[model samples]
Target chain A: MSGRLFHYNTLGTLMKGGFDGAFTFEEVLKNGGIGIGTVDHLDGELVILDHHGYRFDVTGQIHEVHLEDTTPYAAVIDFIPENKTTLNEKINKEILEEKMLGQFSSKNVFQAVKLHGRFSKIKCRSVQKQEKPYPDLVDVARDQAEFTAEDVTGTLVGIYTPALFGTISASGFHLHFISDDHHFGGHVLAFEINEPLITWQTIDTVEQKFPVGDPTFMKTDFDYSSVLEDIAEAE
Target chain B: MSGRLFHYNTLGTLMKGGFDGAFTFEEVLKNGGIGIGTVDHLDGELVILDHHGYRFDVTGQIHEVHLEDTTPYAAVIDFIPENKTTLNEKINKEILEEKMLGQFSSKNVFQAVKLHGRFSKIKCRSVQKQEKPYPDLVDVARDQAEFTAEDVTGTLVGIYTPALFGTISASGFHLHFISDDHHFGGHVLAFEINEPLITWQTIDTVEQKFPVGDPTFMKTDFDYSSVLEDIAEAE
Candidate 1:
């Protein structure tokens, strides 16, 4: 049987400014080989590739994530790709998304995708660590640091969620990038791919684990109606 | 560790008239001891208590569900109750719901509930088997057989889903009843409890398994935006 996509907490909790980390990196890696998320206090961008976790800080510095580091939200899978294809032609994000959509047998299921190759240009963003009494995600996003890297070879780990689950997780594609040199990386805002090898797995099963014992998670009344709008603004 | 709530398919798929059964009841029971669902061809109301599956057909006949019986949608759990209480006073469905809500530590997580005791009255409905070209659930529900039993003892099996996951499962409470004598049962529409024992579990983890290999499930494009409205109209 294929391994399920393991999800920690939820975007809904994060949107409500519940950014404290509850699950450790070591525990997250035990569930999957690759994933993307943010560290404690909404610190920077997290990318897990080849079973190694890396953090891309707001100051454009990359650091190897410690096993004890914690995350507020993450979606990871064992990543046994059912389909593998090479895209020799140059393509932008829109074209790549269209191709991926074409490959899906069902548009309503979760999908895990990985792309490894050269990229002519990749624009990314990372958030600075926040202090107590955290503001909502939309507010924190306003001060996000944006950067661009040109002519970088890297791997992009992406998770696609159907529209039905938009509130629980980010709707559509959420991708993070990390260069082979372990220097350039962040949440992918836009990218131009060049001859990348793409591997994707159609995820039919998902294990969503919530921070039940966390006081913040247990006390707050999450307003899901505004979640999609908040995620749109924050992302 | 608490067992995760196991869910099969989505309410969105059923709303779109995809009624073919995919997972076997035997497979569903392996993941949980108690649950609620419908049998193949949208046959009738299905209830599983004490690891035994039973069907309340439209003709007011209850039958033992065989191992080979299939299901298109189901939500089941190993049912380890975290809290147990008894309501000795008479209470209607609305009041019972309010009390259950009071027991919830968080309004955003899934919950499993079981009620066993005497009841003054119970109003319920069961759908007849459908043909190949299955009509949408709303239409099917319109022609459902409604029945009521007064002064009886039975069990009410229920599952509570948060608003965030409304499209995946029923938003609020979805309950089914089965008399202790096995002579009466159906999807509960209204009920009056008399001194019942209530046991509920706060669900922090969920395992959602989709029918990836089913042709109908793979071909249908689920419209989740109107699922809430459809579910409201249907049930």
Candidate 2:
């Protein structure tokens, strides 16, 4: 089976304040065709679909990600949808998540999900670029920019991480949105979907790549003691 | 660099009492040349060297692992030593770990280590085969068999996992030993190496595989809340 999820760096390292980006979009795309992440200095939310990367800046403007743009953390999968279903009724995030969980054969395996349709309302948030000596993520998130749109057509690109790997990646659903017109997109906070088409695949293997030689990543003493709590607060 | 580590299943799942093995040695050997793991039912300690798999049963008797033998948890790599050194002086586990850490370019990346030489004294342990209704690792470990030997020649097969991925795998040095004669071996508890040749490589990528359809693995609610503490106490 070609179900493999590729991720660079860890959420714990990002939460610990290591914001320098060493892996470029050029390299990240070679591993998978669809994914989500943040750009250099945590500049904005990143969304990858059809092997192309896009960045939703803090001002809620969408930009085609440059090949050379770097990222501190990201997860991508060469998605091959094993199951497809359509939701005819309006559904919220919590209800959708429960429905998705019910369809999963095992909650322990990672999953790649795609939701394409019109949303009655969707809320997103993106962080601004940071200066050197970056503050921890919880502090950076305090000043994040929030954006809300009504009746927008978009695709929610997401990865479902099991709780056992909460530190490496955000546990549960971590999704990013990119509208059809490519004018608006950011990290998805909450949404109400109407008759959306959902496609998902179980990821049997997770290939985690670390920032081996980056000076900032190497020097940083990553402490994950309160990482789960910090992630809950930050995201 | 072919510095990729392949592992089957998560330590958290094993600790949560999911003990039935679904992946076989035949499947595991295809991923790497050398590694360490446990056989079916958590029956014994397993060590792989030069592409050959061996099992150290609870009775301290070494057996050539059959190709069809299954494993619940294991980590393997196509080892190409990036650096090698000889320790002429006697060194204990703590001192050796310190020396190894100094040579590592990044503590965040996983590492594969091999030590071959004579040991003045070595202590090891292995668990007996468990029956149905498997108990948690902390409870099973209490009945583990301990083995000690003096002035023995052997190879210490080990993997170094970072603290950030502690729940997925055991953090720090997790080593298993096998004598040259293939007579004595088990999970290494403590050892005093004398003039041993040490070789290691940085694992930039870790490919983690899950037991997707296994009934027990699917049903078990893996709780990693106290996993780190439990690992510390069990080991």
Summing lDDT over every window of 10 consecutive residues in candidate 1 chain B, give the lowest-scoring window. B218-227
- Steric clashes per prediction: 0, 0
iRMS, all models: 2.0, 1.7
Residue pairs whose backbone atoms clash in candidate 1: none
lDDT (Cα, 0-100) at A220 in candidate 2: 66
Per-residue accuracy of model 1 over A12-121 as CA lDDT, tens digit each: 77888888998898999888689998889988899988777888999989988888988888888888878888877898888788888887767778899998888999
Q: Pick the candidate with the highest lDDT.
A: 2
Q: What are the runs in model 2 whose C-alpha is more than 4 Å off?
A: none
Q: Give the per-residue lDDT of model 2 (tens digit) for A1-235.
A: 2389998888889898878887998999887688999888888999999999999889988888888989999999989999888877889888788889887766788999998898999999999898888888988889999999999998999999899998888899999999999987899989998777899998888989888868778756777789988888887
lDDT of 1 by residue, B101-178 (tens): 887767778889999888899998999898877888888998999999999999999898888788778888989899
| Model 2: per-residue Cα lDDT at residue A201 | 93
